[model samples]
Target: MQAFRHFKRVVTDWFLCGMFLATFLAWLFPRFGSSGGSMHAEYVINIGVFLVFFLHGINLSSEQIRHGLKNWRLHLMVQGFTFVVFPLLWLLGKSVLGTQIPALLMLGFLYLCALPSTISSSVALTGSAGGNVPAAILNASLSSVLGIFITPWLVSLVVGSGSDGIDLGATLLDLCALLLMPLVLGQLLRPWLGRFFARHKRYTNVMDKLVILLLVYAAFCNSMVSGMWQQQGSAVLLMALVGSGLLLALILWMTTRTARALKFSPADEIAAVFCASKKSLAAGAPMAALIFGAHPGLGLILLPIMIYHPLQLIVCSIMAEHYANRPAPQAADPALVSAR
Candidate 1:
C-alpha cells in the first residue's frame, strides 16, 4: 500500500513523466496516431479537444464569475500579467533568447506566455494553500473565457498571419466552433447538472488528463511523421527544458513581489500569484493544434507547455502546502474580497 501510494505521488508530482512515455509510445508506433498515417486518429483528436473545452465550461459557475468580478483588482492584475506583461517579457527578450533558442520553439513559448491562467489547477492550488478559493476560481475561469478571443489575437500579432500562416478569421471560426460554442452549451447545461458534476469532479479531471495525453500522443506522432524532430537536438531541448523552469520562476517572483507591493493579504497573495503565473496546458494543446497545425512543427511547439505544466504542478504543490500550514493572517478587507 505504501509503495502504491508513493507511485501515485510520484506520478502526480511529475505528471509530465507520462508525456515522455506518450512520446516514446508515439515514436514506437508513430504511424498509428499521425494525421496522415494509416489509422487516422485526427478525428479522435478533434473530438477530444471539443470534449475538453466543453467539460471546462460545465465546470465553471455563474456564481464563480460574480465572485471573480467582485475581486476586480486581483483579477485585473492577474489578467494584465497574463496578457500584457508576459507578452512584453517574451518580446523584449526575444532577440537574446532567439540566439539560444530556435525561433519556432520561442514562438511556442510566447504562445504559452500569452495563454490564460489554468482553471482547475489554479483553484485547486489556491484552496490547498488555504488561500482564496472563490477568487481563484473566478480569475482562472475569466482567464479562460477571455483567452478564447484574446489568445488568438495575441498569437496573430506575435506570429503574424503571413509568418505563422494564421488565417485569423478562419481560426476564430474554428475556435468558436470547437471551443466557444461547446463551452457556452456546457454552461447552459451546467445549471441543471452542476451539482452532479461537482460531486463527480474527479471524473472530469480524469477526462481532462486523458484528453491532454491524447493531444500529446497525437502531437508527438505528427512531429515524428513530419520529421521536424530532426530539427531539434537533445541539447536544444535540454535548454528549452531549463528555460521553461526559469520562465516560471521569473513570473512567480514577479507575482509575489507585485502582491507584496500591493499589500495583499496572504490569502489574496496566494490567489494572485498562482492565478497570474500559471499557463494552461489544457488550452495550449488544442490551441497549438489549431494555430500551428500538425505539420511543420506542432510537437516541437508543445515542448515548453508540456515541460511547464508538470513543473508548475510540482512547485506550486509545495508552495501550497507551505501556505496551508502557516497560520492565517487577519481577514483581508472584505472590500478586497480576495483582491486587495
Candidate 2:
C-alpha cells in the first residue's frame, strides 16, 4: 500500500502527467479545442503564450544574466552542442533513416533538435549535481532566447520555405508581436513588477503549466479532428519514443565526452552536460504553434519533445543523484604540494 501510494504521488508530481491527461481529454473531445471549436482555443493559447513569455521576462534578473556571462568557454561549449551539433545529428539521422521512419516523425525529430535547452530542468539538475549553477542559468536562458530566431530559420532552411505554409517573414513578425515584444515590455517594466512576480512565483509557475496544457490539448485536438492519428499507426509513436531515447543518449555521450576532453572542472562539466542535453517543451510547444499554425501534423511534430521531456527528466535525475553521491577528490600530499 505504501509503495503504491508513493508511486501515485510520484506520477502526479510530474507535470508530464497533466500533459498526458490533457492529450487524453483532447482525443476524447476533439471538437472542444479544435481550431474552429466552440471554445476558440487558438485565441486562448495565443494569449497564454504571450503571458508566459511576459512573465518570464519579469522573472529574469539582470544580475543573473551578467553573472552568467562570465564563463565564455563554458557558454560556447553548451551553445555549440545545442544549436550546431544537435541539428547536424538530426540531418545525419534523417539521411540514414528517412525512408524507414515516417516523414512527420522525422520532421518532429528535426524540430526537437532545433529547440533550446530547458531552463528549469537544466538549472535544477545542474544545481542538484553541484554544477556551475550560474553557467547553467546563463546557457539555458541564452539558448531559449536564441531559439526564438534560430529554430524557425533552421527549419525553414532545411525544409524549404518552412513546410505547411510557414512564411518566415510573417512568422517572425508574429513571434515578435506575441513573444519577443511582450518579453521586452515585461523587462522594461520589471523594476515595478519584478518584486511582485518574485513573491508570487507559484502563480507564474501555474500559468506556465496551464499554457502548456492548453497548447497540447489544442494541438492534439486539431490532429484528431483531422484524423491524423487514424492515418498514422501506433508504430509511429513507438518509433518517436525510440528515436527520442537514442537522440538523448547520443547527445549525453557527446556533451560529457567533449566536456571532459576540454578539461572542464567537475562543476562546469556537470553544467555543460545538463544544459546541452535538454530540450524545452515550454519553448517548443509555443514555437510550434507559431511555426506550424494549425497544421494537422502539429501533434505529430510534438511527439518527439513530449517523449523526450519525461525521458530526459528520468535520466538526468539519475545522473544528478550519482553526481551528488560521488566523493570529492582527495587532496595532494603536503610533500608533493611543496615540491610543486
**TM-score, cand. 2 vs. native:** 0.94
- Among these predictions, the greatest TM-score belongs to 2
Q: Give lDDT per model, in order.
A: 0.83, 0.90
Residue pairs in candidate 1 whose N, alpha carbon or C atoms collide under 3 angstroms: none
Model 1: residue 79 alpha-carbon error in angstroms: 0.0
True-vs-predicted CA distance for residue 25, candidate 2, Å: 0.9
Worst 10 residues of 1 by lDDT: 1-10
lDDT tens digits, residues 192-302, model 2?
999999999998999998899899999999999999999998899889999999999999999999999999999999999999999999999999999989989899999
Q: What TM-score goes with each of the models?
A: 0.90, 0.94
Q: For model 2, what is the C-alpha lDDT against the true structure?
A: 0.90
